[model samples]
Target: MNPVAIRDSYDVAIIGAGPAGLAAATLCAKGGLSTVLFDEQASVGGQIFRAIEETPVTDKRVLGASYWRGMDLTRAFRSSGAQYVPEATVWSLTPEREIGVSLHGGSVLTAARRVVICTGALERPFPIPGWTLPGVMSAGAAQILLKSAGLLPAGRTVLAGCGPLLWLIAWQYLNAGAQLSAILDTTPAGNRARALPHLLPFLFSGYFRDGMKLLRAVKREAPVIADITSLRAIGDDRVTHVEYRRGNGAAQRLAVDNLFLHQGVAPNVNLPMAVGIKHRWSDEQLCWVPVLDAYGNASIDGIAIAGDGAGIAGAEAAEWRGRLAAMAAARALGRSVPDPEETHVRDELARCLRGRPFLDALYRPARIFRQPSGDTVVCRCEETTASQIIDAIALGCPGPNQMKVFLRCGMGPCQGRLCGLTVTELIAEHRGLSPQEVGYYRLRPPVKPITVGELAALPKTDAALYAVTRM
Candidate 1:
């Protein structure tokens, strides 16, 4: 939605209402910039604190303290006087800082002096045999249900993943009295040795005691099967069982009504990439991340990235980063920010990021999981399998974009969100090149799916219509 702010063009337009977006909006507005925050959610909190303002789960223990922290952040955003547009979907962002947004069957173009993307992360695709079955979904989707609707798995369910998010979800389900059949951890046993190099900083970091407590609580209540080497869902029409194998062990099956899969999260890069921001493959996070300066400025002028979209730092770090980025933007606009405020945000951001290397190394999914073979479905949007991608590589498919023309891997409704990483990795493995060499989809705007009827219905300026229709 084109927010009717005090000015037709905002000094800053923050695209998200998660921690980073909220904090950035607050800081920018208080520093005398006309700021606006847009989000697709009905409320202000992003996924990390989804439904913080309207959660049905009243018990704080169910969501934990970190989730509640969004309350204060949202309150500050509201008081900062930034125009908050909920249920607004920003479909396109240009290098010139122009925004094409849609809301409630209407669309408009808004301009901003600067744009900060806080569109966080997407759960890394976990491609396995039978994953496209109806009863299988990502762990992130299940968590959304819990947070937004106070819903829980009604029948036998298994959570298969190796990340702090998976463990946190398991602990929350236990607190909310949901039944769990098992927790399958896919972290290779050897990763502990790899993670040991970063263990000293982790011991002193804030994550140490809290992560241990949550892990122990979930282990006490649920059956945890660790060192999983391989996993797959099994069903005819819907997933009914999960088959997984541990190191040098026979495959075992568990009857399950639902399967929630995850490995880790990567930046939601579609918006950034569509606008021509430079990106590179991150070996640590196992995904593509935008190349950015220290204060969250991207390669593009007047655009910045914060939150997990910058990288896979946690919720608290995203908030601090929001402040830093917003303060930097404010300074660029000739506004004065207190020196102490900048120092405080930087210090806290550093503290939150202290143990991140350890987590990245420890929970790194095994190569077998990342580079699946055989009938495993890598691209769910198009139903493209691992063998299909491999065959494309064998037949002289150069990269992901070329495969899109032939195999239609990233040409679906998601526009490469679900399949981009897996396809890149598959090509990289088969071609004996780095993911960097394989590259990613060359995305352009309309970065999101929009109906022609909706666009035509909008009262558009001549320039707006020409911009969309022109080459």
Candidate 2:
């Protein structure tokens, strides 16, 4: 798609090309609205389905049938007649529905009648000892490497933490013939008993079958260690060994070089929060999510948030949400569009999410894993330790915003993406408040880091240039 040929204004602009954004853009364009899709990735598939079109993995069995489902969505999006701007980093959004995006060699401001944010979820904060070490990486990051480059960890790789993604990655590693030394399960022992009631609801959800396949595959190949408590990485320069204890037992050490860690995922609320949208704290999910109506409309009138950015329902539900949000947007704009099978879609969405309660309860990370203890580094970009955050709370820092002033915790290049949750939880635990009362980092544009050259090259005096935050 030609960037110069793209219009400065649209009937609707969708920020993100994941399943949610892709579905929304396709439907909105098909409804006779000029729709444009923007994404930082080189392709349409978001993190869950990275490199769908260009993946070198020929055998679909390696990635499973569910992973291949994104191909159909991307195919539909390609032929949906919507303008797609790949590698465009949307930084700022205004109440007037204008988006500030950095693309190609410079930045541009695009206006739309309505904006839909589907920027999706990010991995929950995994702040543990030696997390900032060189070889330490999130399980999602490791999967991205495998998906995009067909690469896997070379040396002995230890998979730790509790999540579906953790087990999925281990299965993928074994499928790809990579070395996996051990699988250290961090799931608390009582998790199964606690999640037992929710298990009945998920029995007919279709995910149970797939979940069993992954579980059996990983268990068959990998050395499994269950009921682990308190894990730590140890090394001089990089992670060389992992230490852990199990239920008041003596600490056991495992030799390792590569460590993959995961807890769970939370909504990526940075963009919506930057736009000054009202967010509510999710007590069950243990994170803050944008306040959205049934149709995915946010607190703002013309803005809608879909996908996991609204919550953590995973990818299938996000696709249904994308379609629902677009249908709502079409109706709001008075565009005559074919009605979706609302009842069927809603039922499928519910079915897709039926397993979440069980999963959330089963995999809730231990407090030490999420908040950590001692001087473990919490903020990778700023090298801010958990102790520094605790000290800030002791000094009555209140929340992440104030703690940012006391210590440069969330002000680094990541701009609080990595450490925001940890800091908020730390302060909340210290002050005896909830994550809601102790709010997250206050974000301002430019949300993504941009080059000075990009700013200098902006066409000044153009009335279309969106007003940036000034001192």
Candidate 3:
């Protein structure tokens, strides 16, 4: 099959149809650029703005007015004239900016153009004893299961972790008819005390209303505990109990059938890293965000990153960033637009992002001192022990990538999505590089696995043509 014959190029290809990607696509399309938005899920909203086929019983109470705004964004994307392809998994992104998307019918789409990656984020998992148990799941995953599938884990489940997500998921479970055993938050109360000054602006603006709603939900459902020290799920096939230490160093155990854990989120940088975009370690966010200008132009000439994928801002910031990126891309393509409107949008987003007190406080993983137990595997693939990693550090491995070569820490089915950040931190602590300097390891394409038939069908010569053409 000739790749060119099957491929359709667009002026802009947005890889993710979430709040950010959808916003980018809508803005670009409305600006008169032929745009296409691709996503792996069978819907436009990304994880945060999840699509619900059935109106959730908890929608009115749980999501409130803010969620309706997200739905409006989705509707805008649908009507913006941009091609929205759901269930399209983008397997590889070449540095040259040719996007390889696998569609539903085994048909492949090679979209060539300026690409915007709004690939959101995954929840960071804490490696603890019995975490691999069946009933143990990320708080985000539990929320998705409840909101999207109308299902929750069996029996009473403890929602444990730090950050706003903990409260958010607890509310979801409570509304889903699942018993909330407790809300065990690991964030120190003093952290909130210190953040009060920064949070004042949001408070005055009524942005704190969201936090109040979450707190109200927590108060209504279960007891909320702060400064939890440790969590250990206990059971063979499923979680039966969770043992945790309080701030005073007293150990307590809660017997529950399920546990929801969330440390935080890391930028979903696998594909962006694979494409060789310049990344900077953000101390504030404690993650690698693609380095981009105010307009969202990344290090790559025609590639851009917006929203949480660039850094961990919520849906509002993402929407603004997406619009800014689309505007920049349009300007780069020699299109005209109102300069003052773009400037105002950028300034307002910057202010909103800066005003969020929780952004920095919640960006890093909950516990820095907590290391995976020796018996608990560090690298799931080779089953490397945490002790082994410590030993390698003592012998002076350069970084986690080197440790990966020795122990196969990152060469797993999930492709280091589960353990990469932890390994990098461990390596940085050992080698004396700042966590920022330690850096995320490089990713190579095809980022996700692909079949041989798809590879065989690639046009032999069009690689060069696709490389040169910018839709």
Cα lDDT of model 1 by residue, 118-187, tens digit: 9999899888888899999999899999999999998999999798999999999999999899999998
Give the per-residue lDDT of model 3 (tens digit) for 5-24.
33467788899877889889
Quote each prediction's TM-score: 0.96, 0.96, 0.91
**What ranking of all candidate models by TM-score puts the best one first?**
1, 2, 3
Give the RMSD in angstroms, all C-alphas superposed, for model 1: 2.2
Against the reference, the lDDT scores of all candidates come to 0.90, 0.87, 0.76
Once superposed on the true structure, which residue ranges of model 1 sit more than 4 Å away at CA? 1-7, 457-471
What lDDT score is found at residue 27 in candidate 3?
87
Candidate 3's error at 103, in angstroms? 2.1
Which 10 successive residues of model 3 have the least lDDT summed?
362-371
**Across residues 1-471, which tens digit of lDDT does each residue of candidate 2 receive?**
225555779999999998899889989998989999999988879999898898877678787777899999999899989999988999889888878898775788889999999999999888888887878899999998888888879988999999888998898888888888999999888888888989988888888888998899899999999988888889889999999888889999998879989988999888899889999888778889998899899998899998999899889999999998998889888985675677777888889888889888888787777787688999888898888888777877888888878988899999998998888888888999988988889988788988888777655764445565332
Model 1, 260: alpha-carbon shift in Å?
0.8
Candidate achieving higher lDDT, 1 or 3:
1
Which parts of model 3 have CA positions greater than 4 angstroms off? 1-6, 53-59, 105-109, 337-340, 362-364, 369-373, 462-471
The clash number for model 1 is 0
Candidate 2 colliding pairs:
none
